[model samples]
Target: MTTLTIRRPDDWHVHFRDGAVLEAVLPHTSKDFGRAIVMPNLVPPVVTTADAEAYRRRILSALPDGHDFRPLMTLYLTETTDADDVEKGFRDGLISAVKLYPAGATTNSQSGVRDVARVYPVLERMAEIGLPLCVHGEVTDPDIDIFDREAVFIERVLAPVRQRFPALRIVMEHVTTKDGVDYVRSQAENTAATITVHHLIINRNAILAGGIRPHYYCLPVAKRESHRLALVEAATSGDARFFLGTDSAPHPTHLKEAACGCAGVFSSINAMACLAEVFEAAGAMDRLEGFTSLNGPAFYRMEPNTAEVTLVRRPEPVAYPATVPFDGGAITVFDPIFPIHWECVPAR
Candidate 1:
């Protein structure tokens, strides 16, 4: 139990923002994950096959030497997205999935789909081609309570889409609530969910308890302690429908600590360590591989990595870097509010 080795995991969801930020953070993820589904919500966004191709090139160029990592590109779903282009990208193996962000749902999401109905044509084509749709899983209604968005989104938006296109593969990204867990469980085999490392550790208390802690704030924001417990149970339960998607978004410390702070948690640096701590505490360390490595590929119809990573439980706590510097400012790393004794041993 002190030393454990498993297939190198893939981050089913991640945001590698372009330029210096991308270069600064890409190494943290590539160090452990073999592949990552790169989010397309850049300043202009990656909406076409060409855009994805160009971005992929940038990611590969920024990758540190000797790191064997692949960026699984995706198209940002917009009302005017072309189905022909989408299918071509999927067929050519340039694109892995299409992201659906409800307009204004999160950072850089203004160009997202405003009306879900407008993108039905694209969804229909994706269903036909067996391409997966990764969703933010929260409604953007002004009247709806912020904490209630995910559950309400299921009842209002996602449920109808599921009913309309039963064959469309959907990944409920960052399932933060018990309601979300139950919904993903209730669906047919076509449905699965990605659980983030931060959600499993922190709840709303981490954000609004004593004072405003911006680093803990993220869209589809953390919910009650009960919801956190539900997510922990689901992740540790060894369910194939649930797997890792760090959503390890990096925001510069200046922006993150601003008046209206950005929503993201940069956990790529210590994600594996954090996960290992959770699993070991739950007495479910054996199931950690399923949550981190196996289930995601099974759901996406991709093969699990043959390479192995070993984590060793150290007598002293692992000290991950506090900040990663970029050109202008530094990005903060996620702190689990706990000491992590497990560290992933580097490949020799």
Candidate 2:
């Protein structure tokens, strides 16, 4: 129970912001993950094949030497997106999927699709070409409560999309509610969900228990304790429908602690160690590989990594950096609020 080894894992969701931030944070994810589906929500966004190609190149260049990491690029889905261009990207292997961020849903999503119907042509084309659509999965209606947005999105937006394009593949990213888990299960054949490390470990209390703890804040904001337990059960159940997507977003420490802070948690540095603690605590240690390594590739129609990564538990807690320096500022790392004893390293 103290030692565990599994195939090298892939982060199904991550954000490596451009320039200085990208350079500072890319190493943490690349260190432990064999591949990562890099998010396209950035300034000017990666909305075309050319953009994805350029972004992929930048990610590769930023990667530290000796790490064989692949950045699986995705196009930011906008209402004006070109269907032909999307098909070409998937056909040429430059892009793995298309990201659907409901306009105003999260950071840098102002250019996202506002009217779903306007993008039917693109969605139909993606379905025809077998390309998956990764969604933020929250409705941005001003009247809807933040906690209820994910559930409302399923009823008002996602369900209709699913009913219309039954063949299109979908990944509900960073699912935070039981409603999301149940919906993904209902559409089991062509649908799956990616659970983040922070959502599995913390609830809304992490952000609002006594006073606002801005560092724990994130989009699709963590739900209640009951929802966290649902996420735990689903992840540890060894179901192929649920897998790891850390959503390891980084914001400058000053920005995170400000009056109006950014929404993200940078956990790429200790994600596996935190996951080991979670799985072990749930008494589902044996199924950790499926959640972290095997199932994601199966869902994405890719091969699992042949290499192995080992996590060793020690008597004392492992030390993880509190913040990573970036351009004279720093980005805060997520604190799971619990001690982690496991340390992960690539198997030689």
Candidate 3:
């Protein structure tokens, strides 16, 4: 098969934790991506314009020397989030979007919004100002079955919000099910979804494929194989409504291997490699560029990156780091669906 070359891609969603973990993982993402919208779910969360600006600066500082990677910053929406503040941040270009993580939805997410209606005023303001609301799209209610959260959220929360504020731009982040794909497809405008590399390559089976593989776990956790097929079709369809976002969350290795392992798939190391395999298998390698590089910027009304990057088809197994040594411990990297035999060595 011939190698594929395209404009350098941008990651619509990414979580680069602060300090050393950020330092270790940022390089993998920067190497493959032109830019990435940095998630703001730090311990305290980036709640204000000033916080976002400072966080952006830190990300810039963390970038490997001589790399032009840009970290697009975002604001973490909370009960106390002020609409004026959000608007000011966007106007000043300090932030690109506001993230809504329903409380208890995922890691370091307890600080998330407890009630979506309570944040309606904030969403209204975002809609008025043309800033998109990026959401985790899952119900935190313990009563909701883990596998049904995304579908249920669409019915109980997202659908209602879309009706209430049809003008608001919304990105259903890291969508993991067929329902999510259908939902995003049904809404042609003003709404879109980001498909993660891990979700695209694996399914709920990966988490328990041979046995319980904690590293394969993540929130809105991987769904069934049929759901995975739907994701592949949507992503490779060249539809502007779908785009790339690694959601490459990293946790200390110990945390991931514990009795109650944390939720997040650390895919930064082989994100493009994984995507290449998926697209190639689906015979949609021709559409990889738009999914990886163009759609996200188009949806956000931003410029697609000017730089170009290439992915050649070469056989190389992606090695999993048992742990990425950081401050006091190490962060575990998930074993991708298969040993990624096709490596994506960047052509500068």
Clash counts per candidate, in order, are: 0, 0, 2
lDDT of 1: 0.95
Tens-place lDDT digits, model 1, residues 106-203: 99999998889999999999999999999999999999999999999999989999999999999999999999999999998799999999999999
TM-score computed on alpha carbons, candidate 2: 0.99
Q: Which scores greater on lDDT, model 1 or model 3?
A: 1
Query: Model 3 off-target regions past 4 Å?
Result: 315-323
Winner by TM-score between candidate 3 and candidate 2: 2
Candidates' lDDT values, in order?
0.95, 0.95, 0.88
Cα displacement (Å) at residue 197, model 3: 0.6
Per-residue CA lDDT of candidate 3, range 1-348, in tens? 657778889999999999888888898888878889999999889999999998888888888887779888999999999999999999998889999999989988988988788999999999898999999999978898999999999999999999999999999999999999999988858999999988888888778877998888899888899999999999999889999988999988788888999888888877887788888889988899999989999998988888777777655665645566777787777566466656655666
Model 3 gets an lDDT of: 0.88
Candidate 3, after superposition: displacement of residue 232 in Å?
0.8
